[model samples]
Target chain A: MRKLGAITQRELLSLFCSPIAYIVIAGFWLVTGAITIWNADAFGPGKPATLRDIFMWTPFILTILVPAMSMRTLSEEYRSGTFETLMTAPVSDAQMVFGKYLASLIFYVIMLAGTLIYPLLMEVFGNPDWGEVLALYLGLVLLGIAFTAFSMFASSLTRDQAVAWILGAMPLMLLVLSVYSLVRRFEGWQREVVQQFNIMGRFGQFARGQVELDGVVFFLATAVLFLFLTVKVVESRRWR
Target chain B: MIEVRNLSKYFGKRCAVNGISFTVEPNTIVGFLGPNGAGKTTTIRILTGYMPPTSGTARVAGHDVVKESLAVRSVVGYLPEAVPLYPEMRVYEYLNFRGKLRGMDRPRREAAIARAVERCWLAEALTRPIGQLSRGYRQRVGLADALLHSPKVLILDEPTVGLDPTQVRETRALLRELAADHPILFSSHTLSEVEAICQRILIIHEGRIIASGTVDELKAQVGGQRRVIAELKGPQAEVTTAVQKLAGIVNVRATADGGWTRLDIAANNNAQNAVSELAAGRGWAVRELRQEVPSLEDFFVKAIVDARVRQAGAKEDRR
Candidate 1:
């Protein structure tokens, strides 16, 4: 456990010490803030007292932001040859993978936390639905966890950070964009099956203050699956 | 102590490390000498538990490298080639981080960091970011990191590769000091560096250990036929004939320099005394008579050449 903490701490230090983390956080905030304000009409006096727009647009922005943030997690290690020193340490592959994953997750959470001000402003100016706003934040957090895990898995697949970013972003973009279109094109059971895989659609339930067990389980399970695959990839490096 | 037996590693169809075996006993510094693609780094990686051997086994501090890799890694300190470090981290922070990864507690980590800093001459660079430091300082940081855990075995790959001469000398002295407690196995292509520091040398070639012995043992192995150079004031033909006829002289090449003849003799016995005796008997004035000593470089080249020759012969026989 201490070893795991050490690895996480080192990873966090590396992440924050460089300019990448700040740039990613800033970029996420700029895009999310601008879109939310545009949708909310610059949060004008007569606008609805809701942060739903911020929560809705976050996953879309995160598909790019999370990958940008997590791309260097493992790929940079490989390129710099620090992977040798890191893997040779007493930590297991699981510990190393989780350590890095946790660091990125923590950074993503910090970026998410920055948006709390929007809800606070809503609460101050008008009577916002506190429960719905909190639920949306929870959904966004879960979505961020899955996105970061998938990006880190992509990072594990290559030593090039740019390639890792593209590899991570492409699938997520396809999933986010294709599911909505597929939901419309299909009918009956076909639509139901596609809707089941619709990430944003499921997240809409959270926007309505519904924290269903299956939705929580789905996102958590996706995170775990990707993290496991990352561990396997890291272990396979020994064979190579 | 570290032990490897018939360990091999193959990357796809290419065997990076062939079936090779050697041990590093306590208090000894075994220099792993090889050319660029001679499998030294691969062998060190397997021994350090960074990778598992494709065949055979390696043990460090009595733990199997493949089965008990975490246990092996815990007791081994490895400095890889090129000394990869987190460029954004400060020197002290990096050491502390390594200590934490090694599972050392705060008090112990502090003490270890201080000891490593002092030993590696890193006091001045502790607060500086690693990227800002020079290559030599970065290497010292790496060495300090490897020492943070006070490991039972140290495996370093070209620890002094890019250091200046003074830094290299300091590193050698430090390694000598560390050898008092740890069994260090370091790899290098620089024969002179290995010759200066290592008590035992393992010369690898073409993914196999072609030779392994003490410096004197290797010299003796390749220096079986001695060389004697004699400068005598006599006719070249007469001097060559006289030296060739001597009891121990295997062959002699005579060259005329000014009015004197110089005989380069390859011999199996005391050609120096025999040549002097022959010169005195023939009334030839002897200006110089000396036997050349074989260096480690000579033994290294001879070992590689002999291995290649043996390999070629085996291939021919198979055909």
Candidate 2:
């Protein structure tokens, strides 16, 4: 537990001290704001505004940003040689993994926090459905957490940051790609599995205003599995 | 105290550390003297419990390294060859974080950080980012981090590799002070510095202990005899005749300079009395007569070269 706190503190300080967290949050705001303003016709017009515009764009946004934020989570340390020191320290591997995971999770949460102003503006003008708003935000956060886990896993796969970035980008691309009809090449239960496993399909119920435990479990399970794999890699390196 | 036996580490099929064995007593500063790619770093890593041995066993502070590793690691402070550090953190912050990781409490850990900063001369950079510091200061921060929990045993790998002369002297002073109460194992390729600081020398080559003993003891292994040079005012024939009459002189070689003869005498042989007697009996004025001393470098080269030859012989035998 104490080790977890140390890891968390180290990751948190690094995220804030560097421009990583601010750049992530600001990037979200600027991109979403520009799109919203331009589509709403900028200054004075029949701009049918909704809270969905801000969050409706995040899975697509985080498909890029989360990888950028998490590409260095374990990858940078491996490249910097701090990963070896981390394993040599008296802390357990589990504590180290949790520390890094939670740190990135918190940073992603801050990025999500930037979109709060979008909802605040929604409350002033239209009688936007608050439940759907809440559910959509929940889905974005869940997906982000799940995606961050894989990004971290990818980061752990290699010491080269560029290689880590490419590896981190693969899962999000595949997660989006496996849902397309090309997945039918499997031609059986695998096809049925792919159709249901679509991340966008998982978000459908939530965006339309319903709570889905299945998707939540999926994201949580993915995070645990990938982080566990990262820990195993560190352990094996020590043995070798 | 530390004990290692039949320790071998195989990375895939290639062995980084072949079977080896040794013991280190408490409060002794032992130097691992070896050249590059000689498995010095790999051996230190296993001793510190940072990595495990593939076969055989090791024990530190009465705990088995593979079985009771956490207990060993809790008391063993390590500074790897590369001096790993977090660049974004301040010197004090990195030390504090490392202290906590080694299980020190908040108050005590903070105090330990302060002491380490003072010991490593890092007070001025306590608040500055580690990346902003010079290479010397960065190495000091690495030392400070290693010293932070006050572990009973220290394992330092090439601690003074890239430091300028001044910083190296300061680091050596700090290490000398620490050696009073802590058992330290420092690895280095330079024999002279280790000879000055360490009480014992461990010469390794190709993942094996080539030789181990005090500097004098190791030097004595290869340096089995003493060489005496004498310059006398007499004919070369006369000088040679007088010296050969003395006992314990194994071989004599006369210089081309006409009046000088160099004598190789067996260990424990008294050559001065022989020369003085020769000078007294012959009435030849003696100018110079002394035994030449051998340095650690001479011993190190002899030991490592012998080990390499032996390893080659063993490999050929296997084939």
- On TM-score, the candidate that comes out on top is 1
Task: Give the 10-residue window scoring lowest on summed lDDT in candidate 1 chain A.
Answer: A51-60
- Using all chains and alpha carbons, the TM-scores for the candidates as numbered come to 0.91, 0.89
- Backbone clash tally for model 1? 0
lDDT of 1 by residue, B1-319 (tens): 7888998899999998889988888999999999899999989889888888989998888999999999999999899998999999999889988998888899999999999999999999989999999999999999998888889999899999989999999999999999999989999999999999999999999899999999988887887888999899988887788778789678888889998998889998768888888788889999999988889999988898899999999999999
Candidate 1 residue spans exceeding 4 A from truth: A41-48, B228-290
| Residue B38 in model 2: lDDT | 83
Model 2 misplacement above 4 A: A38-50, A177-192, B230-249, B252-289, B312-319
Q: Tell me the tens digit of each residue's lDDT in model 1 across A165-209.
A: 999999998898789667899999888888888988878889778
* lDDT value, residue A142 of candidate 2: 85
Q: Of the true interface contacts, what fraction does each candidate have?
A: 0.91, 0.60
Which structure among the candidates has the greatest lDDT? 1
In model 1, what lDDT does residue A66 have? 91
